[model samples]
Target: MMRFDNIIIGMALSLILCGVTIGAERFPPPDFVETDHVIPSPTVPGPRQDIYEYIDAVVLLAALGLSSYLVLRRRSRRAIFVLMVFSLLYFGFWRKGCVCSVGAVQNIVLSIFDRDYTVPITVAVFFLLPLVFALFFGRVFCAAVCPLGAIQDLVLLRPISVPNWLESGLRLFAYVYLAAAVLFAATGSAFVICRYDPFVAFFRLSGNLNILIIGACLLVISVFIGRPYCRFICPYGVLLRQLSRLSKWRVTITPDECIQCRLCEDSCPFGAIKKPTTDWPTTEYSRSKKRLAILILLLPVLMFLCGWASSGLKTVTSRMHATVRLAERIYLEDTGKVEGTTDASLAFRATGKEQKELYADASNIRAEFKLGGWFFGGFVGLVIGLKLIAVSVWRKRTDYEAGRAGCLACGRCFQYCPKEHERLKKIKEARAKY
Candidate 1:
């Protein structure tokens, strides 16, 4: 397994270097040609692009199915690793990271809220298929089919465990990111998730320099931190985690009864394994009950406070919209607070649009932001309150088990279990007898 991991890492590094070299050559320094009245031509996609998107959706479904089998039935970490490599090649490199589930979240939200927007069937499939699989099979998609996760998984050289408190705190950012992405998409303000996708730069081998730097930094951190982006930042991961908690089938550490060898306890790098817990002491249990009661009472207060605070930031958040920023710029110019007019302002003026109308439109957008902010803040507050409640509560467990929500189903612990090896050896011996 270690050798295979090293080989995959080598191949991935080679591909990255090759992609960078090719990208640098393909996109040389731009030659600025001074010209007057340059006509802009709109480019149209051929049938191939649409066909490719359909193929991508089909491939994604197939990959998810195979990954589920590998993790849940075959119990083959090697097979899962192979699938991860294939996903990185197909979804990451060939697709250039477009039509991806992460970005499709925005498209789906926009389609639902904006009547004029129509989501393509392929994008809908990309968005929904993995979630459906997650509801039944746990996060097999995260284990083997997500190129973003695959890339990070391959680069993980020496992962150190993150403290439980810090890990829990960082996970809150994923929920916040999910809320913000939905808010921006529902309001037709932006696709902030796609715009800041760090791995997309690595996949496409071309992007804004700042984003490229951020991607590089993340990869560097991933060397010591397993799936930093997936665990702490990816909004899509937040959805998967929730669905996986309710999954019907999940990866298990042992094929039979656990022997309490403790080998599998430290095998997982993502801290997904839950150790057996004893009953809480009488004093501690009483104290926890009181704390839970207090937190329950505080939940409503936190929600309202967060909602009010978020709603107050409408003026700042609404500026993310083009119309809002343009209106603000035009207003500054009109009021003589600024000296020169921007191209956008000049274009608006040329359109002969009424300032009154522009201001009204901006006002409506700000109103939407205000409403969305309240929901977003309330959602975040609710998550925080629930998290606090969960920590305050204790559960009794007799055996070490994989966390339903936290496990990536990577099959790392399977190899660490002597029972699993014995089961395999017995099966092999039975096959020989047959």
Candidate 2:
């Protein structure tokens, strides 16, 4: 039975790999689009909307399906490893140097400043669908779906202990980043989250020199630290964490049964699991309750400030004006009526009249900023309220003992789960003895 299970996992992985290879050969690595809005292409490339979507959809659906199957069936986790391999293959190898969610975050941030900026559907899907999944499934997308997160997770073979203070601080930082990204996205100022995405250059295999350098640094860091993006950065992960906290059900160290062998603690690479605090139960409960209260009070203020900070008039104007002007200039030069007067027209047109007034009138930078502030304030308030109510209802330790927010559902812990491992070992030993 164990052999059969392992073979099934291996075969599943092989199929996924074959699919990725075929898909990549057909489409090739995606070219990065410089702007947020769709670039007008007279000749539309194949059926795929863009490279990001083409690869992401296949990777996401496959990962989600496989992970869901493994989780639900309570099966061997070799499939999770397979998904990780495919993510790296598609993102790092096949689709090298293409814009992705990381770039999408940056594009979204850039858009805040540039009124002409509109998020690509492909970009938006990568950012949002994972969030939607997280709302119900608790960071399942981060685990199996996010190419960037999965990349780091794969590289982190060596285990290093993270200090509690550092881990706590990093988690807090993710929240801060999430707040900023949401505020910026809501205001139409930018996608700050994607701009600093370190994995982009690696995935796309090309980008700005600085961005590529950043990507290299992050790749190097992943070798030493596990999932630095999920732990410290990744605005989307931050939101997922909040959602996961309130989630009714989440991935658990033990699902149907537990032998309490403590293997999961050793196997868990990310240090996300907290050994269920059995003694001093009341104290822990009280602490969680208190913290929940403080978070509720503070989230609104933080949201308002982040929204204001990201969308303020000065910030939006300065960031967007340059991009908007560049885009406008390009549009005019492309469309302008001129016969053998390209150079003269460009030079003449670059020195424009009433550009400042025109740009200002065309952009709703100030209005967007105000709207972002209001929206974030309300959104934050709502999230906090939901969490409080959830905590109040599921006040039992068992209910709260599921998993942390943004869990990634990668089943990394399953490798360490003593119950499952013991069962597998017994089956293998029995087969050998027989």
TM agreement with the true structure for every prediction: 0.89, 0.64
* lDDT, candidates in the order shown: 0.91, 0.62
Candidate 1 to truth, TM = 0.89
Model 2 Cα displacement at 221 (Å)? 2.7
The positional error of residue 394 in candidate 1, measured at the CA in angstroms, is 0.4
Error of 2 at 426 (Å): 6.9
lDDT of 2 by residue, 38-73 (tens): 547698667645664666666756666665666545
Clashes of 2: 25
Which of the numbered candidates is closest to the native, going by highest lDDT? 1
Each prediction's RMSD over C-alphas, in Å, is: 14.6, 18.3
Q: Residue 288 in model 1: shift from native, Å? A: 1.0
Residue 292, candidate 1: alpha-carbon lDDT: 95
